[model samples]
Target: MTTDGVEAVFLETHNWGKAAKFFQALGFDLEFSTDHNSGQLRNGDGPYVFIAEIPEDREPGVQIVLKVTDADAFRPDPAVEVVTPFEDTHFGTREMTVRDPDGRLWSLQAPAKK
Candidate 1:
């Protein structure tokens, strides 16, 4: 299947408030927050920003969540690195991860099965 578009931006931040403020300054409105820490923000036309508290074992970074027509159908060249095979995630979506030439990780997601 073909990729639809960008779905969201998964961000790891040390301070949620600071990150939210930074994105807000860039014009993303607060979408929703679980407690005062994690939340989704949007710039009206969608392609949301999902800000999460960085875990001890995880480094602070940003991951692009791409909307794909089918997560299982996304395949790159054989030389590309696959961080994860497509699988059902806890957040209710089928997702997979692949690393680019520069070592940037990208996640391709499809709607969860019923």
Candidate 2:
């Protein structure tokens, strides 16, 4: 039930290309780019940043990723609603999503299950 710290932050951008370039100009190195509508940037240390392009109708915001010991075992608080249940990601992690009371999205992720 305890969180260590933020592992990443996902930012919804209207243009992934522009956003990536912007972050890169600010000293964030491109870790990788994916065809899945998103890319990752990092300062070569902890807390990587991710940018994802979404529909114009959707609001752009930041999603905080929390490192958890067991993403599957972690449940959302009564005040929050589960968006995506814990599932294995193609990038090799177990992740779950929830919408906080303020409507901000949060993700809980754990190392890939062995």
Candidate 3:
């Protein structure tokens, strides 16, 4: 299926404080901070950024979130490997995970069904 476009960037960091500060320096304003050492940031009308803390032993990485206007209508191509089906998120959206041919994971986000 066709996706709207890139919606946000998900980042994993060992040091939440430093990572937040780094993105803030790049002109991203913190939209909201969760008690769980993570937060969402935005620069303007563009896609936002989400940073979450991971264990020190884990390597930091970034993943892109693709926007889907209608999760129920999404029918990905047969070649796409859907690692996880769309599920409601604590943060309010419905999200799905997919692995690329190269084995990289990506996230697809759509508004929760009413």
Q: How many residue pairs clash in all the candidates, one count each? A: 0, 0, 0
**Cα lDDT of all candidates, in order?**
0.85, 0.85, 0.94
- Cα displacement (Å) at residue 93, model 2: 1.2
Off by over 4 Å in 1: 55-59, 72-81
Which residue pairs does candidate 2 place in steric collision? Answer: none
- At residue 14, candidate 2 shows an lDDT of 87
Return the clash pairs for model 1, or none: none
Tell me the tens digit of each residue's lDDT in model 2 across 40-81.
Answer: 999877789989999899989987899888765665567668
Candidate 2 ranges with C-alpha deviation above 4 Å: 70-85, 98-105
Query: Relative to the unseen true structure, what is the Cα RMSD of model 1?
Result: 2.7
Candidate 3 per-residue C-alpha lDDT over 1-114 given as tens digits, one digit per residue, 9 for 90 to 100: 689999999999998899999999999999998998999999999999999999989899998999999999999998999999999998899999999999998999999999
Q: Which lDDT value does model 1 have at 19?
A: 90
Q: Of 1 and 2, which scores higher on lDDT?
A: 2
Q: Report the CA-based lDDT of candidate 1 relative to the real structure.
A: 0.85
RMSD (CA, Å), each prediction: 2.7, 3.0, 1.3
**Residue ranges of candidate 3 with Cα displaced over 4 Å:** none
Q: Candidate 1: deviation at residue 22, Å? A: 2.7
